[model samples]
Target: MSEQYPPPPGWSPPTRPPATQPYAAAPAAHPQQRPRQQPPAAAHKPGAIPLRPLTLGDMYDAAFKIIRFNPRATVGSAVLVAAIAMAIPVLATAALGAALDLSLATELTSGSGGESVTTSVDGADIAGIVGVFGSLALGSVLQGIGLILVGGMIAHVVAAASIGQKLSLGQAWAATRGKRWRLIGLTFLLGLTTAVLLVLYALSWVVVVMTTSGWQVPVVYGLISVPLFAAFFVWFWVRVYYLPVPALMLEPIGVFGALGRAFHLTRTAFWRTFGIALLTFVVAQIAGSMLSLPISFVSQAVLLGGVPGEAGVFVLVMGQAIASVVTAAFVAPFTTSVATLQYVDLRMRAEAFDVVLMQRAGLTTSGGNPRP
Candidate 1:
């Protein structure tokens, strides 16, 4: 105190005495105060399909939205596939017709006897008929394969769109590369099952007719079996209506596993799934018919305008092919998108898939924190 030295160079002492001002206390934060929490950033953007739960309308809208989101991969792929499918069948039929015509002309020009002409015509007709059917069957199989491929591609696009990602045709195809064979196998299995069921039903009717006599017996058998068959059909359809294609593409499951998974997911939600699927089918069919009706009408008019027989046939075939292509381009994507989004909806309702989707979408941070 005796040395109360002056402040160091360039530093001055307080102008007033320390005791002249009372000590002020620091303000305290209220104990109950909380750091304000900002509302969560949305997981999806407006006008985009959400990854969470969806309504039927949401499913429908999402379907079309996804088609709009990537028409190149969805509608473009469908058009390409449908054109190839229709073209193969049309060309094969044309070739067979040409061959048949050539054989008929050859027989006529050779001035063969009636018997020879009859025999030659019969043989050629049978061969031509078989060839036509064979070509048709082969074309159908290829078309089925193409449809499966398109479905798989649509599934991939819809899935990526869920996570705010866009997929080109090549990218979607790449994503589904591994599942292509599985999809084809699944389709074959489904068709085989349907054929077996039809055969069994037909056999049952035959047995009823052969083993019993009178209208009453057949009528009673039909009455008894009809409801049972319908029930069985509904059960089978509800259980397997949603194919494993979406599951195979989106999940890590194999073909059989995806089938089992589909069954499991629809077990409790059978009616819901059935209703939605039925509605979607009806809507798609109606839309497709509307799109193709004009083309069909124009073709019919052209045919009625006195075009040559062969030319009229060609015009009709070409017209139908074009209609098929257009209808397929618009309708196929809607169906696939509905299936895909419905699959997601089922998974979310049954398995909390929204959480996983959110995580994938980066809406949540690591350790379960919502992003600020």
Candidate 2:
């Protein structure tokens, strides 16, 4: 303390602070930060398809899924329908074949002393032919009716499946209960219209033939007009008429209403609809052909090769019928699904039907998560 005095002219003492202040104030206590929240998971796929506008691949995949999920409703119904449809024709053919055995055999004399025999058409043969044709027509009508019913059932199944509800065959049939006659009527109307068009087409060909001078002119005209008309027909049919079946099956509307709806739906997306339909048809055709071609060949080899005459023919016909049944069983449901999905896709695009589907599926709520 005594020596604390400045020893030199410029010397100064060190300064000291009060002891109250800590060496370093504690780091300002940071308020704890809460964890950040993550967004909810993507929309849950409840059934065969996601609740959104579907791509072609999605439609195709979902079609098979629908068939797989509701086999009794889809594939089983298809099998039953196809079997019944085929049965009518088969029974008719069998019955008619036995009943209408052509007895009009004519014996001809030949210079080589070898007897030549030929069949001459008489009134009984004509009656038999008419009966056979009538039976065939009846079978065709029944097949058409069965197809319509099956399509309606498939539509019901598709509707249920879109909402994650799997339907049984009974449920599907019940859903399509009141629509059967309407569907058949629609089909008949459509068929009648088609027949009229075909008649017109034939009449047009007759006109061309009558108007043209020679075979070459008619041939050239046919070569040109046939393809053009065929192309136009295919295009028009795909764009306009192809979707009416699904429309009639799914909606509460009648045949004309369905036709109008389909026309409207395809108006905006012709190429897309056309592409999906064409591709689906091509795939179904290829698959059916692949399955049936082998059967046909094998049946011919087994039935015709060993058996003789009418027996062989009968066996071959039966075999072919069975093949058709199997092919229809596998192919029908798939085609039906694709068609229904097309209707759905079109509705979703045009009507925001996906949101309705999601809501029905319980995949959406006001909150971030789905409602419990």
Candidate 3:
């Protein structure tokens, strides 16, 4: 048969087909597979500040932005409170000056036309001095109360603004109704503490001077005490008391609770808080001075040169009161905003408060999860 096949010209042996490779099934789909977690979304800013840990620039920018965000809640309320507080002082000053005929001006005569020069406080009655000091103390207390109340109102504004809500002046004031006295008491306590400490420091120096014979010990004590006490005061001011106003206003805590909250918030963040507050204060001072100094100088010159007696005193006092109101209008809101934002920032850094704020602003899922 093979010889017969070879005789066919075109006949050739056929090879078996190549073996078929086996088909590999895909690995069974993962059972109960874990879903990949999406990354956290970007910080949401529905208000003046971004809901995140804020930098110094962010705080300052937000503070200024707040002033423009709701003028009625900020500057208008500030001006109203300041005006009322200053009225009492202006009246007291005018009454006392008129009664005592007190003036701090000197008369000079250089020409030969029988000109005379007088340099003395002729009407420096003891009662007048007491009245003047008392008046000043009263004014300080009143101003402190006013400032605290205004700060409280502004805190409301800030809180609302953080959630992109604007408050009217009346609404802001209403928020402070239950908290006014607490804020005022806190301010008074802080001021009294500072005064007591200062008195003690002065007394220490006095004792050193009175008890010791040589100047060396007192000098050395002063050199040591001055810097040390100054540092202590600064620390107390920056790290302890500076934040209470915001805390008291924002949270449902009491006075001491606010104080403790402030202390806690400032922990591990003293330098940042201090630097920002100090810089803000310096800026405020410079701005206030720029706005008020020229008017003061003009009034003083008028008192000395042209205006006379109680009329001059009235002019000066009224001018000063007006200047205070104007300055407070611009300065109070900004300072309060900074303080509030600083509180927010510290809480965010420590407790993820940005998430809470975002949630409050309705930028989160109802399941308490942040929205992507």
- Runs with alpha carbons beyond 4 Å of true place in candidate 3: 1-40, 89-140
* Ranking of candidates on lDDT, top first: 3, 1, 2
lDDT of 3 by residue, 1-372 (tens): 355424578767665454683554444656576446767767789998889899999888888888886888888888887888778767777777767765554445354677776655655644664665566557666776777788999988898888798889889989998899999889888888889998998898888999999889998998898899989999999877799988998899999999999999998899999998999899888888888878788788887787765577677667777778778887888888888999999999998888888788998876668678
Q: Which residue pairs in candidate 2 collide?
A: none
- What is candidate 2's lDDT per residue for 75-120, written digit by digit as tens? 7887787777667656765665676543233323343557564545
Residue 188: error of model 2 in Å?
2.0
* lDDT for each candidate structure: 0.78, 0.76, 0.82
| Candidate 2 vs 3: which has more lDDT | 3
Greater TM-score among 1 and 2 belongs to 1
* Model 3 pairs whose backbones collide: none
User: RMSD in angstroms, all models?
Assistant: 13.3, 11.3, 10.9
TM-score of each: 0.79, 0.76, 0.79
